[model samples]
Target: MNHFKIFSTAAATTLLAPAAMAQGIDAKVNEAFATVTGPFVNFIFAPIPGTSFPWIVLWLVAAATIFSIYFGFVQFRFFGHAIRLVKGDYSDPNDAGEVSHFQALATALSGTVGLGNIAGVAVAVGIGGPGATFWMILAGLLGMASKFTECTLGVKFRNEYADGSVSGGPMYYISKGFTQLGLPGGKILAVLFAIFCILGSLGGGNMFQSNQAHAQIANIVGDYPGWITGIVFAAIVYAVIVGGIKSIANVTEKIVPFMGILYVGSALVILIVNYHLIGWAIGQVFAGAFTGLGVAGGMVGALIQGFRRAAFSNEAGVGSAAIAHSAVKTKEPITEGFVSLLEPLIDTVVICTMTALVIIISQQLIMEETSGHYLMNEAGTGIATVGGNTGVALTSAAFGSSISWFPYLLAVAVILFAFSTMISWSYYGLKAWTYLFGEGKTTELLFKIIFCVFVVIGAAASLGPVIDFSDAAIFAMAVVNIAALYPLMKLVKAELDSYSARLKSGEIRAFKH
Candidate 1:
């Protein structure tokens, strides 16, 4: 308790020091981060020449497409099997790993199913119009293939430590799988992946989450220094993550289900209440998908935004989920891959789509009948926002427009989603940390401490460049990871074939539950 007070006091001094000083420091921090990371961020998210489309998004989509074809659309063909695997029907208690298959899926889901679902969907619908939801679902469907391939490799190449804990992810797979293929630059790629993963874990997974979580809280409780929320959040996160993967899995397994049901349930209630508009909304989604419904860039704009937000929300090809899935206790690496297919489906196809439908059904996008275009802001580049609100605020207004108290409930869900995401990513960053610095108690603890500290900083400061760069860092991971996946995919396919043959022949049978 004494240590807690001391730490809180020191953190407050550093984060809250008079408003004027804090503002200056925040500006300097953002500027410094922008100066250092701006070029890299631009390069990572750079648009294709003469086109608005981000090549990175294309890179991920292309990979998802290739894997879907190469694996014969495994995400769709074996999705039922994936559910059974998650249910422990094929899981052996004697398998070598840390967490159960369900726990692994929960952990991975926790990472992907956060702010991107609530705020991100609103952003996609806001700019891309209702049509974006159509493409978003398609991208997510294709993205399941990406998740399946990477997670299979994640489990295949993971390092099992003497103490029974395991470490794996794109870093391990890139290094080991590349060397196995007798490729050069395996070590270099591995190091680069670890570096980016750490940065992504800190910036996107830790800071961005805490920042939004604090914003939601401040929205509810009048106003206070963001550091206060940060400090409290960090303490709770530290308590869970310090216990390692098992603890994280335990928390996420509970939180993910509850928060998912709560958020999804709320969206369902609103949709039912507005049942009369359901057909019109569905028509809008289909029509807008093709016509762009007067949205800028028309169909193409919707396509880009939908694909972009789905990729961001589900993180299918990002390789972050691979880290969480790698800890599953399964001898057949393909089983985890099968289980992972459900992630993008739940995060994107179900939850993200639900959010999009609610917003669309709520008639949040105002259209001018004479012009047949959305009521745009002064610039007229995109759909106009309500009272200048965007992201979560916009989503909240849409919900509040129906059920008056839903916004408050949504706030609680946001915090829970944020908290769950932070813990899952903590494990992800730790795995990368140990891979780079060597695994040990002190080594792991150090990363955890650093992660917790960043939570405070993230909540307190508005480091836009830092968050942007962190997001780029995540895509940078996809660049390296998907690049490696192409070469290693044949190996994953072989595993899939063998697993399928055995299951078909009754050699691999589900346990009697």
Candidate 2:
């Protein structure tokens, strides 16, 4: 208790000192981050004249689509097999890894399944209209292929530590895959991947989770100091993560299922109450998906919105999920790979779709103006500045229209989502950090302490530009990961063939250690 108080006080001081130092601290932080992330975002969002989507996003989508087709739409063909694998029907308790398949999926899902479903979907509908949801679902479906490819490679190339620990992700794949190919510059690419993974872990995984979680907490509990929330959150996270993958997996398996069911159940109720508008909402989704608002220059705008939200939500190609999936206890990497495909499907297709439905159905009844600009009213409840007109609060308003308790429920859900996300991300960042720096108890402790400290900073400070950069970092990792996978496609196909042959021959009736 004394240590907790001391840590809390230090966190408070650290978070508050920046604001106290200079009147222009906010501006300085924003400017500094903008300087770094600005060009990156621009590059990613560069328009493609022939298509409505940004060139980078389009390229990613096209890559995922072709891979899915090339692999015979493995996501669709083996959906049942994946389900069976996750059910532990093929699980061997003595498998040479740390966690079960279900637990691994939970940990991975915890990272991707949070605010991206609730707040992100809300933002998508607000900006892209109902049409964006359609594209988001489409991208998520294709992303399954991306998830399978990266995670399979993750397991294939993973390293088992001397202490019986494991480390794997894009860094391992980039280096190992290239080395196997006898390619030069593999080390450079591996280092690049490590750097980006660190950035991504800090920004998207850690800071972003802390920021959103703090927002929801503040919304519910009133103006409790940001540092207080940050400190408490960090402490909880530190405790769980210090114990490693087994501990993280245990907590996530419990939290992810409970939170997911709660949020989805609430959305289901709203949809059921507004059942009459279901058809209209579906029509609008398809219409907007194709025609857009006619403002984004037709199909191009629609495609862009869809792809952006999907990539952001599912994070299929980003290589982050591979970190979690790598911990699964299995000899057949393909088993875990098949299970990983379900990440995008559940995160984007199901959860995101639910959030979109609630917003679209509510919007139709309110007849509110659909513009991407924030509107503040005297009631102290309005659209957020960052999201323009289509933000989380707007979706909250829509939910509030049908369910009086929805705002509070959404707030709670957001907090849980954010909290779960932060804990999972700590593992990802720690893995990356260990890869760069030597892995020792002292090094591990230092990273944990820094990670916890940043949680407070992310909560108290405005992280608009910082998160943007982090998002870019994630996409950049995807660029490297997918590039590696392209050359290693034959290896994945070979594994798939061998696994399938075993199953067909009934030689693999069950999992063996």
Top candidate by TM-score: 1
Model 2 lDDT tens row, 183-288: 7777787778778877777777777677666767776777666677788888898889889889999999999999988888988988998898888788878877
Q: Root-mean-square deviation of each candidate, in angstroms?
A: 5.6, 6.5
Per-candidate clashes, comma-separated: 0, 3
Best by lDDT: 1
In Å, residue 64's CA in model 2 sits off its true spot by 0.7
Model 1, 1-513: lDDT tens digits are: 000000111222322223442467777886787788779887887889998888988998889999999999999899999989988888888888999999999999888887778778888899898899999999999999999999999999999978888889999999999999998988899899889989888977888788778777877886788889899999999999999999999998899899889999999999998887788777878888898877889999999999888877888888999998999998899999999999999999999899998887654433332344433444545555667777777888778878889889988987888898899889989999999899899999999999999999988887666777777788898898888889999999899999999999999989885
Q: Cα lDDT for residue 410, model 1?
A: 88
lDDT of 2: 0.76
22: Cα error in model 2, Å: 11
- The pairs that clash in candidate 1 are none
Q: Per-prediction TM-score, please?
A: 0.93, 0.89
